[model samples]
Target: MRLASTIRGVTYSFRSIKEVLAKANSHKSGDVLAGVAARDAVERVAARAVLADVTLEELRNNPVLPYETDEITRLVEDDLHEPSYAAIKHLTVGQFREWLLETSTTGELMRSISRGLTPEMAAATCKLMSNMDLMTVGAKAQVVVRANNTLGLPGRMSSRIQPNHPTDDVQGILISAREGLSYGCGDAVIGVNPATDTAESTRDILMALDEVTRKNRIPTQNCVLSHVTVQMAALDLGAPMGLMFQSLSGTQTGNEAFGISVSLMDEAWAKMKEMTPTKGPNVMYFETGQGSELSSDAHHGADQVTLEARCYGFARRYDPFLVNTVVGFIGPEYLEDGAQITRAALEDHFMGKLLGIPMGCDACFTYHARMGQDELECLKVLLGSAGVAFLMSLPVGDDIMLNYQSTSFHDIPSVRGLLGKRPTPEFDAWLSEMGIWDGGKPGPRFGDQTVIR
Candidate 1:
């Protein structure tokens, strides 16, 4: 479903996962509203109180913790207050569309979308179905969704070093929407697709992010730009198109091209780490599976998938908190069965695997078109049902869109209403058994205060 359309329909229940879990565990209403209110106070006011003590460096150092509701609340409050935190407040579909109309560029288009209640407006409403809770439940939701194997990966682009056009821009936009709008507006990594793949191009973007962050005071030392898909070192987009995955009739150079692609990826990683060091709890966004030369012939092997996994595993190993998943698969390619591989793998292999860390996805944008509105509705259910982060891609004329998801974890006290009373006794029992019940008096330091040293 196009998130932008659903922004107005967005309503937050002002509750906490911990409280809901408690209700599930005991089936009591005694503390439900109170638990939810405590979360709201922490999120709306307390968290923001601690902002002065924190710095980009400190926030990155600890980042947000799974149960650190206070910290996340502050981050959201800080973003809302800080005029420069464009990614947080203004980027919302409702706010963004309004801003677009105000900007010199895309203003006319914004006017068009603003005029009547069109499907675009409906889609925009979904964008509001987002939150700012990154730690606790939001993070847990990612784990649960990943475990459920529902989301899909949007394929990568052939051009390694593509610019921010409609196609490549869509990826980043999607990341933001998924994390920001759908799942407590948390953080996820995103990449740029340059028309060419070379160390220089990669370096240029890294440098650009650095400069932009510094210029805009966004602070770059804490973040890592992700490099997923077909990454290799020293290989420019030039170089004879090579073997062409689109038409691999026979062994051209005995699959040297494939090996080179892998090597290029290595180089890309090395360079990225060098350019954007993972200081503090920085992140690197990466994804895989670009049809590339294989568009015509789908002869992918387990090794390729393994390579992707290894890429993720490597990120996990290098800087435990620095790498976040943004797995992308183009077209109708879901996980092994109908699941999204990253989500499927996480659910099947990574559940309870990592205690504090969270896994994320690109979103549920590519569900089969034939599935129709069911897919869209299904996505909504997934968002509210599982807390899976979603990324929204804004339109670029008729062919391109921009990607948007959270850059940091956030909490939302608004989603409580979306979830009616617990569904079944079995589910409730599972909640109790899982020890996921929400309890623990709201921490004393409910406001946003971080140790910045």
Candidate 2:
């Protein structure tokens, strides 16, 4: 589909230009054409410089640039221009461990160092460290930041559930949601990727979810992941703006194709702020993954992780309620194996926390990526310790529509038990009232099993 167009004589497509343009204009009745036209003009100019020499074929074939070790070294050295530089230079690894354990400001120091290195370098350095050391750093890196919303989304150091369904089937969506909630999940938000990607379909799903939430008395946000234009149409049609969803990337060209810019995002944020249910936290939900810039033909020779951090910086401007990095979802082309995925997930959480953004990790992989459940489990535990804000809720760890395996309903209690954490405050109360959770522990039910006489 033609995902982006510019008046500067450039066009970009996810499939074909006709298909994308058709989808873009499908909500003309809602007056989305004007917004699309304005976005096209801004994106055309923003993308012109990046596409000057690179071909779309090159971008597709070479999604990630080769890492520059020398450049990374220079950047790391430059970043040590702070008070912590002396301690880092003089302390032995053991002494560093002791110091990390002894000091309250280690998180501040680690955040500074993390901001200094590119994600590639951070991953490489972490691979050589022991898991204990990694965990120690990650645990200390947790800062008490909140998204400031009513649903109490991510009010603790625990993970939230994101049970996503294929957009076409309302019944199937509710079924998945019920399955997740039965396991005491969906504290993050019960969201779906709409099949039709139209305003009517999006509105229908949102309204359905709202009704479900009210009936069940689940203290969570409801969302249908459609294009922003389609979502605006749904809002115009009186759909509750419970959760405003968007996928963003680092580069200007990428944001353009996604039909987002600083101005556009600000506009959306204002609209949601004015209309969202007063009883919930902030209404914005954003999904970002590394490699999106390259996928959109917008990489400017920066490392994927670096670009991913830039995307977080952009999202922070809006003070979004939830920001999730689909850490390994892009595939092996960007991150080669389980170890790479693990490090990338840690780096994303660490970086996002340092940036003061409420962050979550979709610790998952595609089948072709040669990753497995064991790798996902490893990353999940590490992120759980790192105090990630939330996780994806796939029934039994498998997403039928997205074709990936992520954290499952069963994984929630497993991680919380390991960390002595519970779901967000409001959801925890709801779970307790439902007799699904007792005193911050999973109720008598476990996994896919039910009791019998």
RMSD values, in order shown: 24.3, 14.2
Superposition error at 358 for model 2 (Å): 0.8
Predicted model with the maximum lDDT: 2
Off by over 4 Å in 1: 1-163, 166-190, 198-211, 219-271, 281-283, 289-315, 320-328, 333-357, 365-369, 373-377, 380-453
- Tell me the RMSD of model 1 versus the true structure: 24.3
Candidate 1's error at 273, in angstroms? 3.9
TM-scores vs. true structure, each candidate? 0.35, 0.70
* Tens digits of per-residue lDDT for model 2, 1-453: 123434547554323321222232211111121122214434433332222222222222222333242222232334323453433443322343445456576666665543332332232223223455555555666443333223223225444445555557887777777777778777778778776888888888888888878877777777888887788888888887577889987667778778877667778788777777735345687888867776676655444555676566566666667888998888776665787677677767755665546778889988877678887897888888777777777688888778887888888777877877778787788777777788757665533222200
lDDT of model 2, residue 251: 65
The whole-model lDDT of each prediction reads: 0.26, 0.61
lDDT of 1 at 347: 31
- lDDT tens per residue, model 1, 274-325: 5333342322333333222232232222112212222232233222222223
